[model samples]
Target chain A: MSTVEAYARRTARRGWWRDGLEAAIYLVAAVGVAFFVASGGLLATAPVDHLYGLGRVAGIVAAVLVLSQITLISRAPYVERVVGHDRAAAVHMRLGKVAFVLMLVHVGLILAMSARYDGRSILAETTALWQLGWFIPAAQAGLGLFAIVVATSLVAIRSRWRYERWHAVHLLVYAAIALVVPHQFLEGSTFRSGGAAWWFWLALWALAVGSFVAFRIVRPLWLLGRHDLRVAAVETHPDGSTSVTMRGRGLDRLGARPGQFLLWRFLDRERWTQAHPWSLSRAPRPDALRITVKPSGDASAAVRGLEVGTRVLVEGPLGVFSEVARTASGCVLVASGIGITPVRAMLDEAHPACTVVWRVRSRAEAPLLDEVEALAAERGARLVILEGPRGPGWGTAAGETLAGIVPDVAARDVYVCGPVAWADAVERDARAAGVPAGAIHRERFGW
Target chain B: MRGSRAVLVAGGCAAIVGAGWAASPKELPTLDLVAPSSPAASATPGATPSPTPTVSATAGATGASSTYDGPVVTNARGDYQARITVADGQVTDVQAVVAGTPDAQSVQINAVAIPALRDEVLAAQTWDVAAVSGASFTSPAFTESLRGAFEEAGL
Candidate 1:
């Protein structure tokens, strides 16, 4: 079979998995509301009762979205494989905003309805609710924590804080979820019945939280135990990037492909608290994995100072900017500045009809240039270097369209990894050159 | 694709509304403004039917009538008491009353639950009825009170 045919079949199958995952999210949310309806929520006649019903539905949807947010970021292999890590995290962020808003609506409507029903002021009803049971008060506390987490996550606030601080605040989401869960089962009329509705919620929570613990926490610890990875050597390049080579046993078992990144935590005193995402600068071998990090942040800068034999914990081989995402026989790999790490690693295993396009300000300052050039020559692949200041197009020269350079650009899959704006320009040019949207894969270099 | 997405959204909304409307009861039970029946006459159950009611006699002349108020049961929410009226060895009516610290939420819960509990008790003619939904405190209190009333009547 030809490469395009095989690629087509693989993508079609993967497309099903993506569709199924998306459909599951919608289905679970719908089922949540359905449970409320089954409990006769829609039968409410009074204005307060109607508001109470709305609160219940809002709470149910919010619960579903929250669970979904957990599942998306759980780093579950199946989810990452289907949607890619970047897409999953993007969805996670979007769902988080929606979930938080619905949560507020749920709390507000429930309070208003209770106040009206009891013929008391809202403040008085809140006090009464606090005295009602332990779980109600616990849920309120969780809501407060949620408010804090969300406030810190806002773009304006988040930009003001360091990544480590922002991340520590974000971890409170797990605690918030734990605190809020008890009231869902204990207080809701539908759930209290201990019937199908109860089981449905129980199973959903188990599935979501279970995946989170199993994949995000357990799998990494297990990998750490099995691999026993430690830094073997560190090389500082002329362009201010540091490449760390780590030696480990049976490293090939990680199933990491070229152009994939991992969240690396160097277990040193100074850098133990932060895990930075860095792509492998070379193809994985049985005994070693390497990462090239450009010093963009404090944690990244500390990579240059890492001592030999420093223990390491990793949470990937994540993302889909690899051969697994290809949809054509020929392929074009494009990179700019530090983005060349993944592209260089990918050249080692790319298709025979591959072309490497490196766009940089200067050849001497480009990281991993020599390695990519050597790999291109060894594999009989063409190389194109565009070095100069930014131009009107993706290329550094005027009228240098993708089609003008790589004549058969439309016949090849295009893989782009770089700064967001440069990558966007490359994608626009690739599309203008007649590349199908699905055939153009991008791995953006930031959170 | 945009057309399909719009259709999908519209269909989802319709399904949700349709399912909710279908699941709802034909008519919701409205809150009763009138006070419940006052305490019935308390009397021993007789093997032979006879008029033996002493206080507030409102029953038929033949059957002996007994009504007992269950001791107030306290839960986290508040206190609940069950009052049951028995005639001819059958519990004809049951009322769940919120006593102390009647939290407004509990009041709303009892309003909906009391009627459901009454139907359950009348249908079974016993104290053992399923707990009403959303009335965790009131259901058990009502059951405890009804059980005491039943034992006292010796039916």
Candidate 2:
């Protein structure tokens, strides 16, 4: 039997998890609306009642989406394992925007209805709402914080700001969520009526916040105390890339895959507050793990100057661009520029039937070509190199289709990593060549 | 794939909402605007009469006239206690002694709703009047307390 069919069967069984988790997110939001209907929302006949009812539904959905957003970024192991970190973050971003708009709608409709009912202006109603409960004002303040966070997160704004500054501002989202929570249970009539609805919301919140505290914060601290990871060696390549190897005790228990990236925070006086995501350039060992950085930004540029003994705090073993995501026995790994970091590590762990396609501006410009070539030769994997610029296809020449290069590409999983446009082209070619969507994996360079 | 997922999500939400609607209280109790003592009146048993009245009616000169305070009824909004002054077996006056949530919205709602409810009960001479519109919480709470007061006054 061909290895392709065998591998297909293996991967087909695991595909349900991603779909199931995605469905669960929407289902949870639906349950929120269910709670509202159960609370007689449908029976609201008057104009004021209708406005209030719709506002309540909007509030419920917004709150649920915010919780989902929190869960996505919580770095929960199961979530990361299933959906991958990049996809999770993308969904988080999408939901955050929707949640924010719905929140504004909630506030608007609620204030409009209240003002109309009370025979008062919107401003007067705002004050009246403030007087409703102490949490109301706190919730308003939370909305302001959320606005600020969203503003700074805009593409134009984020591109200009340093990552550390943007991240510190981003942390305000947690506080926004915290401030918004009290008014939900204390003032919202659906939750205020102590019953199954209330308990359901309470449990949902506990799950989101609990996962965040446990996985994002507590787990990193535990790793620091337990593994005691620190920089053991730093290597600077001729291509202006730096490789830092960190040695830690019992790193096998860290559970990091060969190609996964970790958010690294170096505890140097200058770099402690900034954490950058860097992919492992080699397979993890029992005592050490290594990451290579090509300085594209301020934080990454400073990595070459790190001292050997610098303590590293990490939140990861994240993303699914690894063997665990493979669906076939034979695989094709495609990478460009510094994108080779994860692809190189992944190639080291690929099956003997694997193939490597590396695209670079020039051989000299390739960051880790030596190590990758050595690994490819050792593993007996096919190696293909394309060097040039301005290609009609993913490769350097026009009409260079993926199927033409690798004739059996349809039966194998194709992993593409590089700049966004380059990766998109590769993915498009892979799809056109008859590879299933599930069999085509693309690792975006940055979040 | 994104389109299919959205359809699934929308379908799932509709199903959940359908289930909630199925389980919801189907019939909102419409107020039976007729006095219990009137020959033409057939009171909705739960709306006008409490099975166990908590207060006793004091004696009056003309058949039965007395003041009765209903037992406090609590809901999500807040506490509600209705006081009734009965003279000669008729409900002379009704007042919501405690009626509203701590929120300004609920307070404002009750201010308008309570007076309308009082007029309804006095005109009907029973607690079986319809809930005032836009005051879903306060109206039900008011009627619940008024029902207890009616049973106490034996009217």
Candidate 3:
């Protein structure tokens, strides 16, 4: 069978399983709201009752989406493999925005509903929110923290601040969720003990938080134990980029593939806390891994100065940008600037007939050019270097179309990694050239 | 593919909600136990009445007016208990022994509801009466508890 058909067939099974889990997420939430309805939620005729119901549903949905965000970023292997870390984080980010909206509505409606019931004004009910049970304030704080996180996470705001700042604010999402739990049981209409809603909600929370702890925290710690990763060497490239090589025992057991990335935390006193997501710049061996990065960010900048044998930790081998995800027999690997890191790695792993397209402002700007050319020559593959400032889209200033650069582009799987807007343009050109959506892959790390 | 996945998710949610609606016992099954002379009105038999759990009835220590507390009736909302005071077969006062709600609607409704229902029970001197509007759950539970209190008073 052709590689495309075999890969497609394999992913078809995974697609079903992934879709099932996705459906379960929605179902759990729907059932939560539905339990309220079946238990006379729909019977609310009064304004106060109606508002309460609306607020409760909003609260439940927001809660579900919130937990879903946790699960998405938890680095669950199945989720990361099927959806890819980028896609999962993308959905996670979008869900955070929606959850925030739902939460605001929840707070407003509940306050209004309470005012209606208590025969007071909305302003009058504000004090009662704090005076009520601890969960009330907790829910309030959860909403506030989500708002602050969302505010700081906006692209405009996020770019102005450091990634660590954004991330630290983001961690409050977990604290927010923890605070809201008390009210959900004590005051949540559907969460009476031993009821179907109760069990469903309890189970849903258990799954969300449990998956988070297991995947995000426990799994990484376990990998740290099993693999014993350390910085083998750090090399600075001519283009002001650095490649950090790490030697580890039993790295093959980690199941990492080419084009995949890991969250690297160099356990140095200067920056042991910050983690950066960097893709392997070369194919992985059983004993070693490598990642090339531009020194644009603080942590990336520190890569060139790392001492030899420095301890390291990783939560990785994540992303589905691999040969196994290919939907066609022929392949085209494309990269620009720092984006070439993964494409270089994939060249070693690509089939002999594959093609490589590397874009750089100048020959000096492209990191690993010699290695890339050598790898392409060794593999008997086609290679193209578009050395010039990028034109509109993922093209060089010479004004070359994607199809003009790659032979029979429509019949091959095209993998491109670059700036998001540039990648989107490349995808646009690929689709325009009749490349099927299934055959086009893009690697993006920032969520 | 994204569209299909969304449809699948929505469909699954609908099916789950449909199942919950189906599985939900909207109405309480008929209880063979009779409504005793005490003023315990029926909370929705929907929650199964927690096996006839009774709240302690407090009696007036001294005074012509005697007081009695009612059985605790629980629903999806929470537990409820009512107290009724009578002077020589004449009900003078009725108060919710344990009827405050964590929710605003319940509290607002009960703020007016329990007292209004209490006045109705006192004027009528019977548990059977029209439940005040907007506080249906609390009214019924209050009536049932009032019945238990009346029985305790031996009226």
Candidate 4:
């Protein structure tokens, strides 16, 4: 690489890190300001019941923001480009975590303040939750769903087959967010005064919905209209997995890398409108882009019959997982099942010191195992294939299995993609082996 | 914003302030008319024959009468007499005797109301006249009693 290219690469990497740091700072500062405003006793002096009301409203906003994040991430065609999918996912996770904490505080404060006013025991008030009004229980349900999503995403539960199931379950959070709106508007006293409070709520709702419509609906449609791409070839591996090559007029200038996914909408009359996320199995080469898909769901099933000359819509160059440079002496790339797609893509451009640990149920299920092995051999990197049923024995029983094979695993930066359970288990195992949480990165699929 | 609601709010405020300023009770007239006879003369009407009896019986009277033989005035028009008591240059009490049948409930007035009114008037206190809630008319009557006493005392 030329000196300027090298400097530009380093600068871009630093910018991503800096963005994450700045987001964290802004979140903390906003929370601090909210705390000061709440604690200043101004609300207390106001005749209206203050803290309970504020808590209720904030809870509703938090819920809405959470849903908006999910919708934006799930449906945005250019999400990877706009926020870089991996960073966007991280931001979503962090914000979701913070929102959960705030919701807990909101509920606790509301209950406490309500108890103070009505001279009722906290236990009694909680038990009377159903009687408090329909909104209370609805909000509680939303909170419950939020907690489940966070808990399931933890490093422990994420490493199993259950992770895939949980992905579908987590989508209910959008429903939960929708449920809290009426509760906020009807029960809230702040909205009644109709000043800054009214405008603030209205603006937040508008911005959130506007972001959803812009990123998910408008941007995707615009991209589809501009780039009339068609599937040039469908290459199926021995393992029944497929890579659909899409060729378009301006594929060269698109400048996407391997490991990033695109929301591909095939022009098959039955499947034209449906959009699904698929990872780029190979580096973006001249003339076409390749997206590997495993026939897992309806979207994937449609790719089975995809023919040449079939027009398709591509909304991508997403995910920051590929761009995050491996600066360590040695790196570990853990892939389970179809999670190997991004890992394979990354492996193509990876430095020589990186190791590929491919864990699959059996040798038959190991798609692209030979290609990855060839790459590992060429790069002089260790490639360990654990062929067995998905269980504790497959590096999940203890951190020692992988750590035993590669003692330097503790020191290396680890990137994992797979079923939620496997990813989670790998993360747990890595952490147990003294890997720092920041160094152990993961991207959830199907959620 | 320039609607009926705004007009209503403005009207309500104006009404409250106006009512607060104007609701104070007015000064009552003093009962200073001279009695037809002195108490000593009334105690012994047999010693002197007055032109007429000082007390007259109404339909429901229980036959209680006292004679007053001092200066007397009688006419077809309604006769009015008032008795006054004074002490230390202040009118302490006044009792009016009119020919017409007086409402029994209106015959007695609380002494405190008269004294309170007297003090308020003397001090020129014009704000928030403290009248009894249910006995509003009695406040004016009490004021009149004070006036009569003040007149008798030549204030």
TM-score of chain B of each: 0.60, 0.59, 0.58, 0.28
Residue A279 error, candidate 2, Å: 0.9
Given the true complex, what DockQ would model 2 score? 0.21
Interface RMSD (Å) of candidate 1: 4.5
DockQ by candidate, in order: 0.23, 0.21, 0.23, 0.01
Worst 10 residues of 1 chain B by lDDT: B42-51
| Between candidates 3 and 4, the lDDT winner | 3
lDDT of 2 by residue, A89-128 (tens): 8889899899999999999988887666545689977877
Q: Counting only residues 3 or more apart in sequence or on different chains, how many pairs clash (N, Cα, C under 3 Å) in candidate 2?
A: 2
Name the regions of candidate 4 deviating beyond 4 angstroms. Answer: A1-203, A361-364, A377-382, A388-392, A395-400, B1-155
Q: Which of the numbered candidates is closest to the native, going by highest DockQ?
A: 3
The residue ranges of model 3 lying beyond 4 angstroms of the native Cα positions read: A45-48, A155-160, B2-9, B24-155
Q: lDDT tens string, model 1, A323-382?
A: 899898899988888898988888888757998888888998889878888888899898
Question: Considering lDDT, which of the candidate structures 1 and 2 is the better prediction for this target?
Answer: 2
lDDT of 2 by residue, B47-95 (tens): 2323333443567565665667665665545556677888867888787
Tens digits of lDDT, candidate 4, A221-295 = 676666667888988888888888888766656556766777777878887756677888777776677777788
Docking class of 4: incorrect
Error of 4 at A237 (Å): 2.9
